[model samples]
Target: MKILKFISVLAILVILVFSFWIYRSLNAPYSHNKNNQYIQIPQGSSPGQILVKLTSEGIISSPIPLKIYLKITGTGKEMQAGEYLFNSPITPLEVLSELKSGKLRTVKLTIPEGFTRFDIAKRITGQFPQNQAAGEDAVLKLTEDISLIKDIAPQAKNLEGYMYPNTYNFPRAVTTQAIIKQMVEEFKKVWKPEYADRASELKLKPHQIITIASLVETESRLDEERPVIASVIYNRLKKGMPLGIDQTAVYIAKMENRWDGVINKSDLESNSPYNTRKIIGLPPGPISSVSESSIKAALYPATTNYIYYVLNVDKEDKSHRFYSTAAEFERGKAAYQTWLKKERK
Candidate 1:
């Protein structure tokens, strides 16, 4: 009986030692000198398969403790698939906890202050080809091919100006229609119902507001100046004056495929509806995407008596001193020339 008891104790000790060894080995961190790396867990890979992969990749010391830990923690059925980044030493236990939580990597995309529907469509297309989303051609077709967008945006003629500019995180499996709907819905949410009523008061169409907003968006990168520039467009319109926006000329040049880097005298005289330098009132449609600020500026312009503005000579970005006469504007223009000379230097 004594010999049997001694043998039983020895067996228990051996089992405990092996269990400890497995846990420590599997849960050990990558060494201090280890390189930064990422682990990709393929979709639907079982715990056993993942363990085999990790062991082979040198991410874990051994699969034994990993399997044992999963079994012990009741997480064998909870692992998820995605790419995981590890900059510092991370233990198998840490990785398992993160994976079970389904924390996937995310990327950021920034749409600038001014973008046209066409420009935005191309940008979305570039990102979607690699993912599950519809290809660019298909999405753009949905825009002009009303059948594709009717379900997404009933009010939108084409997807033009409907895609709201903002940072977005597109999941790997997100569909094309889903992406378009999200952007248009976001734009709808920002547009106030009262703004429509206000447009009625001004006898202007909502489309006209968007057109002016696009001009404001292109006119200045300075957020504070958009409303003031919008006021200039509005004041010019009230008096039946030409908008004379250089951006419109550029747009015409781009459309005609004659655009060089610099705007020339011929572009200013181009006979296109979008040629604001030649035509009266706002352009036919929005030339580019607009931001909320520019839209608000179009809705409510600055209350000012002045209609003329020129870039400040000493400081082009500094607010223009509003002017009612060309002489004042010319003086401002002279200061702008001196500043331009200094800038070129």
Candidate 2:
């Protein structure tokens, strides 16, 4: 009887010690460092494989305790596969919860208003290594799929202005074509059917309206000023005068792959149709990605005879002064030139 009692006591003590160890392992934070950590749980990874990965990534001190705990809790088969981002010093329970949630990691990409396809391509290529391997030229070539916007912009050479500017979440392994397709789809969603009628009223095609909107987007930063700027563009087009927008010169530089963010004298004198300084009418295509407000401004221009505008030097903001006559325009231009010289100095 004494021997049996001693054996029972020994067994109970071992069970208690084991249970305490399991509890501590489950609740204790496990990480090599306090910095943010990321792990990729490839598709179709088994629970054992996932635990091994966690151990290899230094996310867990040891997988044995976690494996035992998961098995005991009947959650061993609950782990899902995807890339996971974790902050260090996270508990095993938290890590398990994250894996089960299956919220794979994504790249947050922001395409700002007035970004050109070149700009967007550069951003996409730089953000995703999978895309970078394909090269920026390959990404830009993907945007040339005219079928993406054929219904809306029948005359469009490519999906330039139609790539609506917005924040997008792309997976790590996303392709360039998928990114452009989604952006074009987003543009389609914002384009109302009534805009087609408005374009017709302006005697402009959808592509032409987008081209004008791109001009407005690049020309002015103020929302209220967009309509007036659009009016200026229209008035100039109607009067058979050069638009004289410096941004168009910038656009010409981008097209010739010589854009260095500075508009030189030669760029202004370039004979490219995109150079509004030398061109008589609208450009052959959109110059940059446009926003809805810019598009609306293009569709509904303000009633004004103003044909020229210069940056307002007096204001701290990026505002402009509009003028109808050449003399008034020259005055504003002179003021701008003086300010530019002072700034350069």
Index of the highest-lDDT prediction: 2
- Clash count for each candidate, listed in order shown: 5, 0
TM-score of each: 0.79, 0.84
Best by TM-score: 2
Clashing pairs in 2: none
The positional error of residue 87 in candidate 2, measured at the CA in angstroms, is 4.2
Report the lDDT of model 1 for residue 54: 73
Query: What lDDT score belongs to each candidate, Candidate 1 first?
Result: 0.74, 0.89
Report the C-alpha lDDT of model 1 over 1-345, residue by residue, as the tens digit: 999999999999998999888767766776433346567788889999988977776766677777887888878889888776644476888767777766555545456667665556667677655532655456566545434335433454565555678888876556667777777677777777887787778788777787888898888777788788988888899999998889888777755656676899989988898899888887777777778898889898887766777765545465555687888878877877887888899
lDDT of 1 at 117: 52
Candidate 2 C-alpha lDDT tens digits along 182-209: 9999999989999999899878899999
Give candidate 2 regions above 4 Å deviation: 1-35, 56-78
